[model samples]
Target: MILGYSVTDLVGFFAKGLDQVINVVIMFIFAIIFFGIMNDSGLFKPLVKRLILMTRGNVVIVCAMTALIGTIAQLDGAGAVTFLLSIPALLPLYKALNMNKYLLILLLALSAAIMNMVLGEVQWLV
Candidate 1:
């Protein structure tokens, strides 16, 4: 009798955990669909392309601009969005300069961390 009760309790706990995972998966799917629609609509592409064009032929300026982008991304309330925008631009520069990919990634992470700390203060105000 005790064994049967224990098994039923475990099943109940597992079902609850599974339900939470399902909820999270559903939310993620919806977010991806929304982001995909925006991307397909060319809403963010033009701005990104313009920034790429403006930074051409200036390596230092491009690096600074990327850091600035990372900083601004913090303000927009999503670190992943900032990372997605910056990494693509950084990869080409890293390859051309023969820079260590890990180091570049580390610097990018550090910049994001600093920006997040600054932005956290803004959150307190809200």
Candidate 2:
């Protein structure tokens, strides 16, 4: 009766949400693997190395650098790729500074949010 119909509708909605989540996860995994492969190919090492050298052991500067990278990555419409690439570089600086791990995490989240909001229009133009 009514109860059966409601249950069916709830189940259908749950299934659709699950499917969307699965698709998103699969897409993320593929993007990560592709970015990782590119990094491993030495395509990005020169750029990353130059950045590391430029930072010169400064934690605040390193954090800002990662934030900039994250923003650029978002502008390129690939947050995951930016995160995957920037994190390894940032971690050593974070450790060296004895900074709280959560600070970097929070900065990343804020940077992504700001990038998405500010860059959304710019992305559409390109």
Candidate 3:
């Protein structure tokens, strides 16, 4: 009765989209678990630490490396997943180096957006 959709009608509509909904839910769960394992196993810490050492604590180098990491992270064309994966890995480094958290997020967002566009991630398939 509300918005021309009775309860049964709404149920039917939801049933129609159930598979797509389930797939997204599963994807999110898997992404979270995968990233969790990486974080738990200390997979990314060394990389970030090395990058910090290589950059010699220069803000510019750190930001550029962060962007590069974000760009590589987006290669799979999933922005949310990229952010979920990159942010945790880089967050500690940003804090340790005393860099601005805003800058870290900004660089990641910008690089991911630009790389996604360049990689035709948003292009419709024929």
Candidate 4:
């Protein structure tokens, strides 16, 4: 008001702020929709079964696979998307095998951290 800015200019500023975050918003929306569809269509069920078979009920292999899958999921560079992609897909295997849920969280976080660090370095180098 003191600077005599019009009301439309202030409203436009709000839109500009949204413009800065619109990509993130769209990413989250698409991630949710894509994962939700994949999940409901039973795609992850077979993948989980195959993972379980490959591990043969071995805790170490399961943990390693969790780390590997977490790293793959984190390639998208968004934690929510990573978790949405991994956690539900892995939870049944963890339950069936009686593994520690904390391990699930830890491995996912660590793998994601590593990927984020590596990608950051790559971006800086480029």
- Provide the lDDT at 10 for model 3: 89
* Candidate achieving the largest lDDT: 4
Candidate 2 C-alpha lDDT tens digits along 62-122: 7786677677766665666566655655654565557777887777777888988777877
Least accurate stretch of 10 residues (summed lDDT) in model 3? 117-126
- Off by more than 4 A, model 2: 1-5, 26-54, 78-85, 123-126
Q: How much is the lDDT of residue 63 in candidate 3?
A: 81
User: Which runs of model 3 end up more than 4 angstroms from their true locations?
Assistant: 11-48, 121-126
Candidate 2 C-alpha error for residue 90, in Å:
2.8
Whole-model alpha-carbon lDDT for candidate 2: 0.70
lDDT of each: 0.67, 0.70, 0.83, 0.85
Clashing pairs in 1: none
Q: Which 10 consecutive positions of candidate 4 have the poorest summed lDDT?
A: 42-51
Estimated TM-score for each candidate: 0.51, 0.60, 0.65, 0.64
Best by TM-score: 3
Candidate 4 Cα deviation (angstroms), residue 120: 0.5
* Per-residue alpha-carbon lDDT of candidate 3 for residues 56-98, written as tens digits (9 for 90 to 100): 8898877888889999998888887788777877777887788
